[model samples]
Target: MTTLADIAETQRLAMLSLSQRMADFETHLKASPPGADLTGLHKDFSAFKEHVWGVFSALQRQIAELSRSVDVIEMRHRKKFLLLGGVPESSGEKVPETVASILQSKFGLSDLAPSSLTVCHRLGSASDGHARPILLRCADSKIRDLIWRTKTKLKGSSYVVSEFLTRQRQTAFTTARKLFGVTNVWTMDGVVNVKLPDGKRRRVFSVDEVVALGVEHGKQLDQEAPPESSSNRKSATSPPSIRSRRTIKKK
Candidate 1:
């Protein structure tokens, strides 16, 4: 013998629970950094699924309660009809697309700008283990800096470097990989083209790619310069000894 008031109260409670669950999900999403490990993302999405199911359950109960509250049978039938007409609770299909659409609609395209895109074309080994496309956003400057340092360290290598401007960093990397048979891709602050040893070409990040190219340049310089023998090294090292002897003589 549930009264209309009781039904209304139940609906209110369900709405409140839904609101709280939605809030919690939002908090989790906000706290998570972009490009978080895929394994961790699976866990987050699992929780989100649970919360969404909870919301659907609550809403279904609310609808049932509202249908029960109508005095007239015809009126109750009409209400039921309206409820049925309403969007059905998701069966969990197209979750990614739905979420992406919602984000795009709410925040617009500009909100999702990538913080950095780095592309490494050559990484020491013949396999080019480090050459890949990398895309990172949100406080990934440390990774960018590491790539930059690596580039600078290898700047004297035998490579050609060129920079490009483009909106899609991933596309650039894909293009580079196809062109140069690169195994890895990195996203960084900017874009560039790197020429490989086999006369192949690829798109790479400006900072790190440039640094690697610089290393190649240095290598070329070393090749052109005369090699220093042990005697030459000893001569170079003898300057301090000579200076010390001269000081002793003056004393």
Candidate 2:
């Protein structure tokens, strides 16, 4: 607002103040130990990562436990169910009549009414090219149990009935069969069994159980060449039972 010399003096003073501030900033930066701070930050992050992993691990364990519980419940529900395989498909066939006949004749189930069966069906579409299995659900668990026990009676017959097992159990059954042969491996109400080294059979319900057996005694079993007897092999491959039903259970 006054003379040019006065204005220039003010400008010079302002520039000096800014330069001092810049110098101070540089000095403060130089004094600070950036590497030490970085190390502390890294340590903090590592601790956080470990804590997260621990939480995740616990969650995984809980989920695994829940899955096992669900599997057990499902297997229990299927305990009263059976699968009848190898019934020929025909058009205009009386499915209920056929079922009644089979139960009366082949299964020797007397005085069973149509209402005694809760569910019955051939499982899938005819386009699958394979013979559809029959899924039979009885009103009483006792009836189903009786039918399941009589499966051995149907041995070498054109029709066969087997316990309905979950897919995982089925896979385990197949694995046991591969290792232990047909006779040594069988299922009771979806519970898989394999003959042990001591001539005693042990129940195996999970794939892990079968895997452990293979890991522990696979070599010894193979060395012993414990092949299935000819009778058992014949029974295993023999034609499965056929019951009249549209509800086909998956093998």
Candidate 3:
């Protein structure tokens, strides 16, 4: 019952039906006109992006504040700590004994109590078998302050001592040192010091403070003594007028 002529006629009818459907779809799409306001959409998206960025920026600020607060707390906890560098390390070494010996012999602090040594140990993760800095904690705040003040005495010796400060403060101190030179910069109890041209020391506690000090130091170096003031220079350069002691009588 299915002949060649019948198959040809069915294929023709299917192709005609598909063409009609496509034409109808095109007509519908043209009628709809897709009137989406692309400009308005872009503006809305930009606003949304700006709002998101604002929130992200606020989060970044909060994270920075959190980091700063944590640093402050940690620095407060480490207020009684000191770092001793360039000390030789040996296997099975007793840190407390070595530190005590150094303090007594080098610093001449023979009266320090044994109990005042709260903690003492070498710090760092060196695998190359090098000596690391020693972290020593004292029980008394006054003793710690004294040690910090006297650390400068270790300058010529093989061993050197420094206050244990927060990483941020340490970085600021390094920056200050680079800016102001080694002789003019020092740190004590997390405070940075810069010796000015006037031979006075200024205390700086933050990176911003260090930067401000650097700017001030630069200004001091670049500044001249106001060019000696033009009036003062002219007066000094001009010869004194010869005045007659006797006044002439008027006719």
Candidate 4:
């Protein structure tokens, strides 16, 4: 499997190669006699520059493809997980029971048992009276999907449930929302969906895709990113590591 480390190393090597080519070009420029024939040297330099550009572009394309592939896999692994925000936080509360109560009361999943949650807990520090979001791993993906679909019932409530997207995708989702308005932009199954003003629909994966669809297609970048009144953020740069939090076993 291609890891982020592998991608970083690939980029480092590509940059190193480009740096060497630059150094070689400098050496050639310095070694040329004061009044050497200009035509052949210019032609050679042009060809060398194009060659380096081609290499760099190819490397960039490869890295983007690799990152997308890794992102797809990571989201697939989180298929059974869901993020629940705005629940009241308390000291040493029973997370599984609390989450189950929300699922039962709010989402109309009354029949859903607390045991269905393989893992559940509040995320991050409890400082400043902020309610820490809960991360839940359902025993079945179907239940997770059901909860997400019924999220509209939470429209007026303080609670919200969202996809456990990777940070890049989360940013893309938020940027799409800012550009297109919250009504036109949303995430479905971890893919950011945007409805353009022209009545066209676009699904974006990365932040770059979001920028292209929004800023480039709609208007200028500076004009499109809406002002920040409240920093409404979702997810993180990387998915929270669940290995240590996987202590719960399904009943």
- When sorted by TM-score, best at the front, the candidate numbers are 4, 2, 3, 1
Q: How do the residues 1-251 of candidate 2 rate in per-residue lDDT, one tens digit apiece?
A: 66434644565566567557656755765677856455564566557656755765675566557656767887887776777776676777655566666777777887877667776666556534566776778878787788777767767655667776766677777777666667778887678889876688789876777878877775423443357677676666422333333543432
lDDT of 3 by residue, 29-119 (tens): 4565477546654566557656755765675566557667877786777676777777788878888888888888767889775556877
Question: What C-alpha lDDT, on a 0 to 100 scale, does residue 94 get in candidate 2?
Answer: 59
Stretches > 4 Å off in candidate 2: 1-49, 113-115, 127-129, 219-226, 229-231, 237-251
What's the CA RMSD of model 3 in angstroms? 28.4
Query: What are the runs in model 4 whose C-alpha is more than 4 Å off?
Result: 1-35, 224-251
Please give, for residues 17-61, the per-residue lDDT of candidate 1 as tens digits.
977877786687778888766677668878877887787788677
Highest TM-score: give the candidate number: 4
Which candidate would rank higher by TM-score, 3 or 4? 4
lDDT of residue 221 for candidate 1: 20
Give, for candidate 4, the lowest lDDT window spanning 10 residues. Answer: 234-243
What's the CA error at residue 20 for candidate 2, in Å? 49
RMSD in Å for all candidates: 32.3, 20.2, 28.4, 4.9
Range of the 10 consecutive residues with the lowest summed lDDT in candidate 1: 238-247
Candidate 3's C-alpha runs over 4 A off are 1-37, 113-115, 126-129, 194-251
Backbone clash pairs for candidate 3 read none
How far out, in Å, is residue 162 in model 3?
0.8
